[model samples]
Target: MFDKIFQLGLRDILDSMPSEYVSLKEAVEGKLEISLNNGLKHRFDAEEVRKLSSIVPLYLWSMVRIPFIMVKLSSPGEYSINGSEWDRRAISLILNDLGSVISVGQMELLLREFKSLIFITLGYDSISGIDNDKEGI
Candidate 1:
């Protein structure tokens, strides 16, 4: 009863959250439990949940070319002699050397999906009583 009303009010708040957030409006209002990765579950209006949350894609753009990274599109781009087949070999050699020195790594493997991260920020849920402020109060 009370939860339903609270969920209605939180519609705007939930939507304001960043992408990959799972809304609990469904469980509060409609008794639906939507499960996500990392043991993070959300039960909210399935319709609203889809609209409120998004999957934030992780991009691996790690590169060592600091100076060349910002180069614009084709205002006289530099190539190591396009006509020479050796150019490919040379480039591959450079990349291999860089790979040897550079470290490859991942972070927060448990939080695979972005939604799980958002849930972590929000914390987990428990049973609500007449007064949510005090436990068994």
Candidate 2:
């Protein structure tokens, strides 16, 4: 898994994204939009994303051991995200690029979404942690 993330590098995926500098007010209000050269569009919800930023880096590092432990401790879901040194560098670069446009306060959301995007793009099921079959009692 690590080798895979390394091979797919964030730079190669995000490439050159053309972004606009938005005010902190706009960011916190969830009014920021980023359009990549590949036609991918990201419209951020500040409250939601900001809530996720601070812990994302740590999550990324630990995700390799167990991805969704926080979601369900009993099951803890899958054990994947085996990253490499290059992947670390790629994450740094990606965060740096994100930081340039996103305000410090809003970075958590961005990082959280970014992590999900990467995981989903790499063929991981976005809903893997949800136990749809569980009975509601």
| lDDT scores of the candidates, listed in order | 0.26, 0.36
Model 1, CA-based lDDT: 0.26
Error of 1 at 116 (Å): 21
lDDT per residue as tens, model 1, 44-99: 43443232222211121111110110101121221111212232222233334311
Residues 1-137 of candidate 2 have per-residue lDDT tens digits of 98778656755653533333333334444545665556666565554444333434543432221111111111233122223433333334444542112233333543465532232222223224443332110
Clashes of 2: 5
| Number of the top-ranking candidate, with lDDT as the measure | 2
Model 2, residue 52: what's the lDDT? 37
